[model samples]
Target: MVFYGVSNFITLFLLFLLPLHSALPPTTTVQINSNSILVALLDSHYTELAELVEKALLLQKLEEAVGNHNITIFAPRNQALERDLDPEFKRFLLEPRNLRSLQTLLMSHILPSRIASHHWPPTHLHHHTLSNHRLHLTTNPTGAKTVDSAEILKPDDVIRPDGVIHGIQRLIIPRSVQEDFNRRRNLRDISAILPEGAPEVDPRTNRLKKPAPVPAGAPPVLPIYDALAPGPSLAPAPAPGPGGPRHHFNGERQVKDFIQTLLHYGGYNEMADILVNLTSLATEMGRLVSEGYVLTVLAPNDEAMAKLTTDQLSEPGAPEQIIYYHIIPEYQTEESMYNAVRRFGKISYDTLRLPHKVVAQESDGSVKFGHGDSSAYLFDPDIYTDGRISVQGIDGVLLPPEEENEDESSTPIRRVKTPLVKVASKPRRGKLLQLACSMVGSFGRVCS
Candidate 1:
């Protein structure tokens, strides 16, 4: 009887596990054909759209749709999705809970029937989408083809036997999707607000005191320079003496730590010396950090620093000006700088030197700073990054274009002689001589 009971228990457990095993996906996935329009869409220049489709888990659905009949897809150009799209709306669509809305949005871009650019109707025509939403087809006043409000930039961009893709200038969002996003955003905004007293400012620091704990990496409400106590010059104010209450971060310690890191980082001793022994700006920089201002230091290596002429450093506040030009009042890592250059081709950043900006561009797969002969490559990236302070080492010193132009203009030019072209007929010397002779003869003096 005991053996029979054990057998029964084992049988019941096996029965419970059987359904789960059956629910698992089959060993073989339905292979997508190389020539299918769906495959073309995935492999075409519409990479951003393809990524979103994949993220929305609509690949299988698209595949199924393509398998049934011919279809057309209106793809938004990468720029439209990357730069022109509303960031909050994009966020709303990408939320996991709003998966249905995302699916509807993507589906609204596709039509059941293949409609090429040439086949578009002259008059307004309404068609049903894969999401069963109505899309109005028409042309603009200039005769540029348009779907709803977005202009078709590239007509029949990618054509396969199964379907066609038209690139649009912007994403054509459905009204339903817009309403849904607005609703979600409103709710989020309401929930994010806290019932707190008026903001307080520290008299010494001149920074607004946070009522609650701020998230890591959050930008300060005020500009770094604004946080400085009233001062006559652009130079950083002397660090406050330790008497009042301290903030969450020990800005002084963080500054010291990074300076130590620069010393140990092998190629950056000159930069360390400038921050520590060479100047008192380091103390002020630490105060800025403690007041919730971040900084990115573009440190020139020892070799680069050695190239600086004595005249460049001999002037009053010259060293401070040079260092100020290198320090950006923001926290940026290697990945962020590289990404910015890669995306925008060129990016400009404001530096501590008021009104001067640093121009960065993508060069040989790295961030190149400054311009012309004075440019420097980001050689040692992210040498130090501790949420508030960031340091990047470079192979060459960076100088502003104005300063570079000034140096070039100041260089002594060697004098050279050339055969001069007669200008203004040499002031009519022959005529003048004739007049002189006539006047001298009349005056009873012999003409030479």
Candidate 2:
């Protein structure tokens, strides 16, 4: 009897232990490679730096340098690119004719040898960059470090066997390049007064002939407003015009024109569709725009919207809620955003959706939104702004923090029902228990 009892106990133990072993997920192994550091940066939310490396085609060069020599990179956070750099300068670098300048600017951020924070000396030191430009580094008595004029905000952001990254507070522009850039920009500004293809002046009246009137059905022309112009402040919506539709204004046509422009020209077809078909938001947005109410839209690009699962979008009222989250009920032009960042370091504003707020942070020069692990940058800022309506392009969809928390906490509880079995004897009861245990073990293993 003692032997039988011991055997039963052992059998039960083996049954539980075997299932657990089989149910555990297999461990996954990731192979580190040349691009591993870059991947790490991306995983750590350093997307802006990753993009610059890819755009300048410096990844291979950085990788090769890592293999042969110690490499250090002065990476500018996304905010730097967005809000810090001069708009004209950024445009100039992107121009096809300025590829060499673009490469040079990118290379100037890299040092041939690794220089960790501890290695930095109190006195000014000279380091050679890949661009062949000599960068002057200095550490002050207060322990503030700078490369050229750019302050080192974060040191040893990433230190690995291959390379290291230091986050800078500003972009480094070499003196020679800066001088040339300024000269070119000045000439360009001067030339704007007399455009190359502009029509000859009518000296008789000192004014050109009026252009032909636009067709009745033609879209309204979108006026380009200066980004530096004062942004709109919160105010009561205007009452409807006499005998006009309740929500309609004389500016409604312009609002429609803008939406159409976004659809056909701005490459926001998916967003446009959501506005037009998914909800009555397009009409509502138009009304808001026409009423001169200030609004800023965190417009997600088509690719970002494409990442959503069918279920996420198909649920009732989900699409509208998501759209509401994207629209900030304030006029936030690029200049305003930059000023906000400079003044407060960060800004938080209520979205169209009640109680949900979007957080904005200015880093380096760019602006990033949301917070913690769930955040995205304004990949394309100042897409379209006219004091009353501002549309900025974002790279990802943002979920409200409360919604995310609720989702994490509310897991579905599943219950299994077993068929009732009538046992006639002790042997039958024992057999049923064994069968039930085996079925449960199998099911548990499968679920796990």
Candidate 3:
């Protein structure tokens, strides 16, 4: 016990006498003002990348971005590059096919806004990079670490400036995300054919003609918003302006305004900071509405929207159909609807000005607007908004019926056939004949 205590004390005394400079980073905080740091990085032992970027003029751009602009640089080390880069990517950058690849490679490291390692939110998130699209810093669900999915030969090349730059093991590009966007755009789906029109189908009977529909189950798909108000805030909502005022609106600005109004009316003005980051599909939305294209929007409530991801809303053409579904062709309200049991009959209606059918029904005591899955209860019958469209809330996601899988190559199901046999029995036959005769009420021919 005395020897062990002596060792610990000796270790502590040695640490106390050690030079502080060798024991820690110079400072936990740093300040940047001149070109000294960049020069020092160039002169540092990490010569391979520094040499390549020097030849490529990467340093020139870095100097420009960092000139008194406080940049954080993630500098990579020589051994780190050899240790971290993907073998295939390393080969591609060295190849001769791509010329503009170097610029892409360098720009991938820059971000428009300064983001220090400390400022990085400790949560899973998708962030836009300096290049406008590529380089999403995907933090895992645990949020303990982050990566760009591309090689960072050396991580955390600390620099005192606007932001940090790490020497990436290879160049970064936007091919994967770009390709995914294309694939989603091309994939086909079952769409409702309007009796009169839909881009995917003929205007005749409105039945599917080619590329037959799939079985989507028996649920009736209907529009979901009761009212188009932004959120349930008590703040005064934006009045639906006439077409002229709406036409000149900056799409992003309009959405922000709508969000603010919704928050105010919903009594959530305290969340104004969050409203500042709101997004809009307004320009596209306006185009669809102006062209008289039907739109229905499945807006996730604020609770739902907060958890929404890029996977949910990043598709380029998604806003079109989504907006179409939200719009009913003409205004519809419960008071204007025919609810009499005698008047219960199927009638075609318009959504975004396109023809659709509303199945009407009446029971022993109640009136049903639509049966089964297609049912929509008019929570607020005359809830009028903007005088352009009427609003009603619905409980579940409404969609067309699930159809049978009609792929031709599949085999038919087998069924067992019954055999036929006749037996002669005098006494039993007499009873069978009587039974048959009993089956015929009016005619006594069988008994005769």
Candidate 4:
């Protein structure tokens, strides 16, 4: 009898919980349709926003919300995210621990209900975001629509039966996100509990003792000439070590690019061939560039190069001597050269060839290089200029003063005309040729 009474009491207790269990609502999963607004948003031109939404992992939650009511999304332009967004803030949002903050920031741009441009109120009105943040919608006096601080660049940019998207000029940042970013970025405040003191001051200078930070875009303190390798006359300089010094520019690539540009720019093929094919000057130039040296090449056109005789190129190292006279150690463009010549009557530029300087002057409203019979005019202003390597095209080849004088005086007829200036019975070859031959002979190869 006691067991039957206890069993009846247990049955009555179970019967009491049945109504409570039946009163609760059933749970159902909402399936996203192929033609849904969510799909449209993902496939739309607003790819940046879609990527953020997916990264925030709000798709499932948003799908459930969409199943219940329509939503309005304010999308920023792609450039705003790619270029205008602060790198630090973007990094903060992408951090694993800041996932909630990212979701909140993205959700703040969305409204729970459809609010198209036409549906927007004429006066200022506040709407609740999916994140439960308030967004102020208003129209300016000029009749342009705005949400929060961003102006609507395109109204009703993407419209679906269930939702609408408006294109905005920039991102709409929330106060919470701003505060979170500030709280995270401002390290001084977080470490304020630790004792702090004033910066150390120097007794002699009466200024902060710490070394001054280098300013952006300041030129390097070291001069280009100091970086050049020293060697015997006409001998190849050894390559610079990797860890020797800090390089401010990629000199080797710049030199190669300038040479290639000369080849492609037309009318400079001869100059390019002599530097790259006929000699190892191209490699030497690359090394010079790699060591932080800048070079300005006064390239002669093919027509001018064709004027050279067999004797000019036949001697050992003659090609190098001719080319060296054309290469100025300083970086100069057409504009700088023209301006310098215009300011000063004439300017003499130092070349790689030792003790030789090329003179420039303004003539016929253009910069003219060299002088007298062998002078060349700056035909092409700037063929290539990349901070380190500059190439300018000229109409004629430039010969050194000594070479010009020797050519004029070496002639028998000229010597007969002026018998006072005694000319040598046997002509002497260039010192450069002798040095080149000696260097080449060391390697058991004939230079000529």
- The per-candidate count of clashes, in order, stands at 0, 8, 56, 0
lDDT of 1: 0.81
lDDT of each: 0.81, 0.68, 0.42, 0.78
Candidate 4 lDDT score at position 314: 92
Worst 10 residues of 4 by lDDT: 237-246
Write candidate 3's Cα lDDT for 1-448 as tens digits. Answer: 9999999999998888787747776743233345455665666666766665665566656666566454544444565456555444455455445324544554555665566556665554555544455445544565444445443444455454445555544334354322222222222111332112212223465332443332221111122221122432222323332222222223333233333333322323222333233323444334333322223222223432344356635665333333333345454455445453446455444333123334444444333444585454333233222222233433232332344567644777676998978987566547877877777854666567
Q: For candidate 4, lDDT tens digit of each residue in 359-427?
A: 999999998888889999999877776666788899999998874565455446633464577766875
- Model 1 TM-score, all chains together: 0.42
Best by TM-score: 1
Candidate 4 segments exceeding 4 Å error: 1-232, 235-246, 403-448
Candidate 3's TM-score: 0.30
- Candidate 4: residue 413 lDDT (0-100): 65
lDDT of 1 at 393: 92
Full candidate order by TM-score, most accurate first: 1, 4, 2, 3
* Candidate 3 deviation (Cα RMSD): 25.0
Clashing pairs in 2: 79-365, 79-366, 80-364, 80-365, 80-366, 82-366, 83-365, 84-365
- Identify the runs in model 2 with alpha carbons over 4 angstroms from their true place: 1-251, 403-448
| Residue 112, candidate 2: C-alpha displacement in angstroms | 39
**Model 1, range 150-191, lDDT digits (tens) per residue?**
789999999998899999998877756755664464345436
